[model samples]
Target: MKHLSILVPDDRSGPNTVACIAGTYHAFTEANKYYGTLGRKPVFKMELVGLSKRSELVNGMLMIQPQASISTIRKTDLIIIPALGGEFLEKNFVDEKVSAWLRGQYKKGAEIACMCTGAYMLAATDLLNGKSCSVHWKSAESFHQLFPEVQLKIEKLITDEEGIYTNGGGYSFLNLLIYLIGKYYDRQTAVYCSKVLQVEIDRQTQSDFAIFSGQKKHGDDMIRKAQEYMEHNYDRKISVDELSKELAFGRRTFDRRFIKATGNTPAEYLQRLKIESAKKALESTPKTVNEIMYEVGYSDAKAFREVFRKITGISPLAYKNKYNREAAELLFMNDAN
Candidate 1:
């Protein structure tokens, strides 16, 4: 049997660790039971792994004793890092012991996986310096600012490369777990777990769920004014060049400062702003697509749809249908009719 080690969180991390560990442990053990029904021996020998044998979870309410310490486990087939809480990325809980041990295990041939914000600890190992990975969209900006070398693919629900795996926010970790189940076992085992786990097996993108509130923390007053202008005047067809001239900065300089401050070009910021507005209208208003498009300064149908899809990874009508309360009632009423 291959050893499956699910690494427990440190004392400084969040309570999210509790649920993440439980979910991961349950899925693998439940898969073993499924295998028993098929007359095959259990393939995974599972353990709750951590730096110490007994690690106290924070907030003084819970405690977890790992079945194996990383020091005791010389080698394992896989390492699972649950979603880390607190300021792991900010270095408040940078465990050099854990990071070094992870690299050592990888060199000895262990596949690694991180669920949601656990990507922080994975990156701490320098394993993801140049690799592509996904995490919850809410943390995308902070992760990018801290680890610019990493290719942050927050739009993706899951990313896999060179035996390392990561997934998007919260319960989406279930999808990552199912993915591993499939890879470790067989297709049937993965499928069986999917049905029992109530997880959709084909969810590919987290983009549709993303809410883009543009980065605005940078203290450049001119750039901030430019952002406010674009936001307040989203209905107007504005130009960065004209705005730059008005703000007494060259267009190129304005673009540079904007990118440095917001991590997006002036054009990208404008597009996101427009799409956000269109998203709100699509979700709440009974307005036509053309009306909303024109309302957001888009006159051409193709251009509007293209920008919408580019920013949101879904077409306008699709977003509306997925989220609109009015659309849901209309569908139900049509069925009744």
Candidate 2:
């Protein structure tokens, strides 16, 4: 049997932390039952492993109980890290005991899976250095600042590297759960669990969910002005060269400072801004894709679709059909009829 240990971190990520534990535990147990019906032995010997028996989280609003302490687990095939509560990069994330235990387990050939921002804890073990990871879009910047060597793939709902697996923000972990079920169990069983759990199966991208707020935290007044100018003029065509000239800086200096301060070239940042506005228009307004495209400063449909897909991983109409509730309902109802 494959031994499975799900780490119930000493710090909880609010009520969702417990939900992650329960979701993982429930899925594997259901897998066991599926195998049992076929007269096969259970696949996973599962335990909620932790450094302690219990932990309070979210200002004592929630509490979790671990079934086994970390020290008790002599060997395990897989170790899962659930999303953590509290600030990620703070001193609390540097839980030396848990970090050391994780490193020891991985060295012994245990595969590690981290859900959502729990990558922070996994990264704390220093095992993820030079590995690709996916995390919550909101935490992407912070994670980069803390672990630059860890390649962060913010657009993916899940990322797998070597023996480590991670998923994006919130309930997207369900996608990773479904993936593991299919990989370690069987595709049929994975489909069954998705039906039972009511989770979307085969979800692969979190790009549609990411909000591209400008990264303007760096201390550069000129760059700040450049960003604000782009923000206010996103609907109109603005030249980066002209903007640089107006700011009294050479184009090279402007581009360099913009990339340094915002992590995006002026052109890339402007594209994101236009795309973001177009996204809003698609979500809330009853407008044709062409209209929204032109309104967001893209005069060419082909150019607009290409950039939209490049940034969002989906077409303009697809984004609208997915997020515009009234349109989705109408389209679904029409199809149902």
Root-mean-square deviation (CA) per prediction: 2.2, 2.2
Question: Please, what are the lDDT tens digits per residue for candidate 1 over residues 1-337?
Answer: 9999999876655677777898998899889999999999998999988877687775757889998888899989998888877653464356788888999999899999998898888887788889999988888878877776788888899998998999999889999988889889888999999999899996888888888887766678889898888989988989888999999998889899998887789998898888988999999999988999999999999999999988778899888887999887787799899
Best by lDDT: 2
Off by over 4 Å in 1: 219-222, 245-257
Q: What's model 2's lDDT at 197?
A: 87
- Judged by lDDT against the true structure, how good is candidate 1? 0.86
Best by TM-score: 2
The global C-alpha lDDT for each of the candidates, from Candidate 1 onward, is 0.86, 0.87
Supply the TM-score for candidate 1: 0.91
TM-scores across all candidates?
0.91, 0.92
Worst 10 residues of 2 by lDDT: 85-94
Q: Candidate 2 at 102: error in angstroms?
A: 1.0
Clashes of 1: 1
